[model samples]
Target chain A: MAFNTGAALMDALVLSVVSNESTYGYKITQDVRSVMDVSESSLYPVLRRLQKDGCLETYDREFAGRNRRYYSITEKGVDQLEDYRVQWREYAEKVDRVLFGGIDDDKN
Target chain B: MTKTEFLSRLAEELKGISAEEREEALNYYSEYLDEAGEENEEAAIEELGGPEKVARIIRANTAQSAQGAQPAAPKAAAEDPFGAAAQPVPPSSAYAQGGQSAQQAQSGPAYTQSGPDDTQSGPAYAQTAPGAPHIPYEGYEAPRRRSYLWLWIILGVICIPVIIGLLGAILGLIGGVIGMLASLIIGGATAAFAGFGLIIKSVFLFSSYPAGALFMMGGGFLTGGLGVLACAFGIWLIRKGVPFVASSIRSGWSYLKGKVRDLRWND
Candidate 1:
């Protein structure tokens, strides 16, 4: 509900996508939407940021009726994602262990 | 809210927000709407909480990221928290709307509450988040206000001659002496030449040149009035806000150009 959650969620979602091959803009937006709620406008800047930071590489690809830019994950992006995964695993494990011992094994 | 109104209002609220933020919020709402089966204004507003709140959340996260601080990541959220039965339904995670791998969803470091790169020697949070650059207002100085004293000075200068000319026409002899003295001091040797011309002509051709005499008298008065006008103008210029005439004119021209530009921009 806090403001940061929205952005954190977006970052999580974006990192989710870039972990694979490069993706274009519209597709990323769609992918984010498939799992959560988001607008095309919001996704645009995030994609731009990822590209700017060199975490992802973006190129244009024509889709539907227009050219949609796809963002592909970079080595740096992968490294970043791995670092996040490590942190996440630790946190999630802690939360799980606190709430329901050994239950963490069931969800993942 | 109908889809169009929702989109429009959302657009207006998101006006200055970064593109990434707008997209993220919209995507979140759209997914909520699709799943919740709610389309009314209240529902939309409730889901979004409040425009500013949503914006602030987005802004804070972005501001932090811009500052380069990220939080600890959690274990990857299950792709299908509801299990395989709901899997065919796309799990409807706003984020997973497109078929992306779990690894991709796990992408990027978990965001931290702290701002960007504070560990470095430089100032913490100095870096703006990617895509949103911080622009300082100091960089854009307001156009300087032009002084209006120049206008008053010019008007005053123009008025002096008219006043002196009227006085000269009223009391010819007395006005002639006053005009001669004023002109002598103000106009220097030129005033002496005109005075001598008046005197010589008056003696030589009093009756036959009465008309010429009157014309010469009018001419002398005009010259004296002009001298008065110049002195008045110089004094006005000194009293006015403008330090000098040239500067005033320059400011006036620039102000005029500025107004024109404003009109053009408005158009």
Candidate 2:
């Protein structure tokens, strides 16, 4: 894509992924990368940032006789996601207006 | 390389961070590799861009949390992150380890030797002390992301108020100077009017007392001349004042507009 996703967008995507179900680091990265061109190793810092900011929490879940760290969205993370959605909606609408200024049949 | 080699190198690269952070990072990476299973382990490692890059990312986060004054995580991160002091390590993540580097890693042994509670994965753990003091690096580039845009936005947001306050102060100062000049012009006019009145009085006194009339005339001319000079000076200042104030406001507005452009919101 020509456009680069900003930090807010990335944060929103990560939070959204975890919001659906508690998952592990590898899964989160894979899901996020499926949509955007993000580096595989990039999600760790984002996870750590959100974790410290109290947006996400991690816990150990046993799988195949090994512990896999699972991350679940917190209340703060949900609120942050909501905020991102609102802002993104507004942003997308504005961009659409500028790009499709002559699409006169559009209704709000 | 195998997951063990990747993780051991990563642990080595993250040698300076807090033990708590290091151990968590190791567990996370180790789990990541295991989750990939034997078949995709090489691909996973390759996707990670090797352990060096992963270690760099972890270290960068550690620095950021250290200086950011974040709770439970010591403060740090700018372009460079701070190395948080050794947080008390928890031994829980160390469970269910393979026969990886459980015995031969040097850094892990040093850490476990000092740690009252050590875990099983030797190579995965980085050396850290309980009270390890934070050493913040200056201007360390943040993680490889587009977050610098966000940082710039934040910085602009913080500086906006300060810039406005300074602009207000400068405008006020210019307004005060202009105000004083206006008053001076009025005062000069008043003095000139008084001097004219004195001169007319002197004319009236000329017939009755020549000496007194002469003295009054001399005083009137001196006062009139000083008043005119003051008036001229005030006018000159006012003439210069308009462009000076306008340019100041223009520059301030220009700077403010540039800042706003960078921080353009949807609203």
For lDDT, the strongest prediction is 2
lDDT, candidate 2, B156-213, per-residue tens: 8999999899999979987888788988898888878888888999999999999999
DockQ of 2: 0.10
Report the Cα lDDT for residue B82, model 2. 16
**Where does the lowest 10-residue lDDT sum fall in candidate 1 chain B?**
B117-126
For candidate 1, state the interface root-mean-square deviation in angstroms to 1 decimal.
Answer: 13.4
Count the clashes in each prediction. Answer: 59, 15
lDDT of 2 by residue, A21-107 (tens): 999999998898888666667678778788878999999989999999999999988987887677677667766776688366465
lDDT of 1 by residue, B35-134 (tens): 3444454554554444443443445435444443332111112221111112222244424424333312222211222222211111111122333333
Residue B180 lDDT (model 2): 87
Sort candidate 1 into its docking category.
incorrect
Interface RMSD of 2: 16.0
Error of 2 at B232 (Å): 57
Model 1 ranges off by over 4 Å: A1-6, A37-41, A102-108, B1-267
CAPRI level of candidate 2: incorrect
**Residue A14's lDDT in candidate 1:** 86
Give per-model CA RMSD: 17.9, 18.6
